[model samples]
Target: MERFTSGAHEFLIPMVFYSLFCLVLTVNVAGAVSIQDDCHERRCNNHEPPVRFPFRLQDQQPPHCGYPHPGFQLSCSENKQTLLKLPRSMKLLVKRIDYDARWINLYDPSRCLWRQLLDLNLSTFPFVDEIEPAASYTLLNCSSQDEALYKGNRVDCLSTSASQIIAFRSDGYAYLDNLLNCSMIGNISAPISPYFFRFRLKWNKPDCGDCEAQGKGCRLKTNSTEDQTECFYIPKHRISVRERLMIAGIVLGSLILAMIFIAVGWRYYSEKKKKEGLLKIEMFLEDYRAFKPSRYSFADVKRITNHFKDKLGQGGYGTVFKGRLSTDILVAVKVLNNFKGNGEEFINEVGSMGRIHHVNVARLVGFCADGYDRALVYEYLPNESLEKFIFAARGKDRSLSWERLHDIALGVAKGIEYLHQGCEQRILHFDIKPHNILLDHNFTPKISDFGLAKLCSKDQSSISMTTARGTMGYIAPEVLSRNFGNVSYKSDVYSFGMLLLEMVGGRKNIDDTVENTSQVYFPEWAYNCLDKGEELGIRIEDEEQTETAKKLTIVGLWCIQWYPVDRPSMKDVVQMLEGDLHVLTMPPNPFASTDPTKMGATIPRKPVNRELPTIPEIE
Candidate 1:
């Protein structure tokens, strides 16, 4: 019973949401109808109900306003009285038109209504008397002397005509005393009234209120029938019971068909989303349909990493743990931090690195996206990273030789170039520094850490970004200022230049531990040294290393130019690396310092933090 109740509770949640949606829709529809029919509540004058759409007041509405039925129409008189006009030179002073009841009380302007009684056969009108429905009063037009032949109780003398022809009413009774001189004109709409000048009328019009209740617009038909006596909602060519049934069936069938489609679509969407949300994702089973990766469970990841025993490194995104595969092959398992505002890094790695295969780039072996536990698997790099070598302690034997650093730079450049052009989609690695460059057993550099990578079309030259990305020293001038240029592949080039200078300097761009702020901003100091044809303060071992360092410095300066357009492409940088030192000239002052002589000038260390426009996050 508890299980059944729980299952029922789960089902009721969706039902509740759906019911709320439908209720909102229904309320909106009702509100719209109320707004339209609200005019029915409006009075032409303070004392009367408003002239409704089907019966618009002449001056108040357009020509198309009101019903088409001749008898159903009403007009305001010169004296501000509402009047209902009828045929045969007659008009009824409208006392009140009960729109709800579909009943009308009428008054005759002239009290000589009894005289016109014989002439007033209202069979052609759309109304019959509500007081005595279909009741008729028989009248006789005879001389006053002949009135004595009639019984006193059955007859009432109306009035004596100008021609001395007396009119009298023969109430619903067998008055056999009537002479052959009386002509039976027609049936009266109702019984004889004591007042004789006023009566009530019930419209034989179609039920407009009921039609509106069924969500239909109402109008009048000039051509009348039993069902559509005068007014109707879309008057049919033939208003038969069979026709009505067929129409009703068609509407009902269409509604049912629409409901079926909605149900099917909702079910399909729900099932698709459910499959995506499951721990064992069936979605990625097709993510690389032909080239599927080895799937791993959360337990498998934890076991392979030995419960994160051999930690490789940790960053803003996650911690990397060294793991050994079944084939005794080493792998780097980046176990993403679950608490970090939804695991976007996992998606970035899988979405970006999953698609490409290149010699210079890191390979994504597999992934583990088990609900809360998410991790990325990559080919392990044994030599740690270039950062350890770039910023090695003084007299450390571990520093990379200039020849090796140049090759590493070339490899890194190639990786970035491949990311920009070789892939099906252009991948912009927003965060690129020595720390992100991993070296394999062969000392071949492979670019890693795609946490801040963004994919765009290869045809697109530039990308728009909301917030600043990458380390402060390595970020491009264009990235910091739109005035410099648009953030593009050139931005990456600029970062690479900064990395190159840092590699040569053998320290970070901003060394906060240093006392002097001028020497702290390394880019400016490097520029000043290169400008004066002075030897860069690096302990060069040989001429080849010296030549390689000089060529790299010139290229780095060229790449770090303030404008994105001024920077060389990664391919160009690679070509410059392979080219001779004599072929390259000293690039212009990229820092745009007012005085190159002022070596004491301090460079700004902070990246300009600009506010980005609002955008929705893509799951």
Candidate 2:
């Protein structure tokens, strides 16, 4: 009897469990779906507002999650901002949404709501402003002198130096007597709120007020063909002992599958990205190997640089380290950073330098493009850059003789000329300053750092440039503004001209530390001094040295003319620098202008040099 009782109890328990599992599987096979399965509230991002009925996030929620009508859709921007596209292609950012109030606050993505209001046509949209009465406002373009009249009401962004825009209520236009100077540009009818640019919009269609009153959620009917909605009781789903076990198994299995997929996908993506980068470098090297620059391995680079022991210098591109191939042969190895603008700077340096061989141009000994590591091996210059010697202190013995300075200047100009015309295609050294000029033991200047260089056809007079390039003070006026002239080889000439002025004055072209505010800009002060025929040096006894200073100043001023056409080419500059001092003529005052303020007493006076007794020659 005891054995029979135990056996029967075990069989009954197994049967009950098996029967329940069969029933649940049959229910699932019958296509029974929960009413509130996918229509639940969802958000694009945690910071963004949750969306439900009458509005839905397009890609995130199903079609039935939102009302089946126009203007009820929302999307997430790449930056995770909630976005709503209004009529006439006006896309605005959804700042906030109040579900109970049935209103949403919207602001323009461009941060210029007035510009959107200019072309706004909201008749096609479902939302409307019910609080503030829509009023017609006349946009007025008035002279900047009348900015005080509009004060806080002025659109600062739309306003320029010559004119300003003011929004005036159209009804009060006839009453205002001081609007004669303001010309009406256009008229827009929008809600006038104290918030100015931002406004609130409310929707009235498919209202869910009754559901809120009953403390229940509302949604459209699942099976009904019509646009019928019903208030639903928010069910608290309670899991029984058996149901809890099933749910636990399903969740654990899903998590395992998800983790496996993620691991495999991440590994595949990493390998593909690495392969693509290495393939790109290999393809480039295949075409560039003919240039005869040796390619080194990563291990070889580390060995040559002595594991990056001796630090040389660092800049925007990367860090340089003093390295050696042998005890007798030395190399300056520049270990490039991973963020090489996607290898743009590295490619520019290698591609431009590989095609040229000159006495004044730095030699590219070898390079390493292994996996993620990159380095450029260059002929190490014992004297480092010309910047170290040129801007030496007042009493320092680093200063060079006038003749030596002339030779360095000529060498740099010749190197620039070679880059422009000596190559197969013209290579424009967008950045040309003393910092880039490397010097050997004999102080022979070699142009280095071709990261900012650009290559174009030799006959292409003006290269198309969407954005400005080069150092701040040395950038050509034409590069900053097309009004001056097109950007060409003449751009480099302007940079060289700035370098020349800095060399001659023994100070920066723009020095704000001087006691005299007027003479802060050295180029203008030097031009004024040369124009007045004043002595540039206070204690220079040699006449030849003074002449040399004057010649360099004149050449620099001529090269920095406001217009590119007015500035001499590098070829002409070379001739002027090498010619006799008497043959050189005074350049037109670059600072001279037709503007009254410049011509008046506000113009900068002569610079006072009390630190140095002599004009320091550039090394």
- Against the reference, the lDDT scores of all candidates come to 0.70, 0.76
TM of each candidate vs. truth: 0.49, 0.49
lDDT of 2 by residue, 1-619 (tens): 4564476466557555655665576466334334456767877789988888778888888988787876788888898888886556667788888766788888776777777767464445677776766666778888888778787567776778999988777677643666789888877765534235577888777787778677788778879888787878987656567666666665665566557557655766776799899997996686466446788999999899889999999978789999999989899998878354565556555766776878899988888878779888899999998877777764468777777778889999999999988888888889999899999999999999876777777766767677898888899877887666678888999999999988887767776777766457777777777788887652255989888888888999998877676789889999999999899888777665333223122221223211211111111
TM accuracy, model 2: 0.49
**Candidate 1 — what's its lDDT?**
0.70
Clash tally, candidates in order: 4, 0
**Candidate 1: tens digits of C-alpha lDDT, residues 1-619:** 4564476567657766665665565565444434333223234467654565355555555534565566756777777777677666566677777555676777888765655555576656677766654545655555555655654522343534421233334444445555466655444453335245777777745556665555445554544453242333442244458545655654565576558558756766776677668834654464467334565888999888888899989988899999987767889998878345565656665866777777788888888888888888888999988887788774468788788989998899889999988887778898889899999988899888887777776666777878887877788876776756577778889889888988888888777565655566676777777788787777798888889888888888888877776788888998998899999988877664534344323333333433323222223
Model 1 is weakest, by summed lDDT over 10 consecutive residues, at: 610-619
Candidate 2 regions with alpha-carbon error over 4 angstroms: 1-291, 338-349, 593-619
After superposition on all CA atoms, what RMSD does each candidate show versus the true structure?
A: 26.3, 25.1
Candidate 1 stretches greater than 4 Å from native: 1-292, 338-349, 512-518, 594-619
lDDT of 2: 0.76
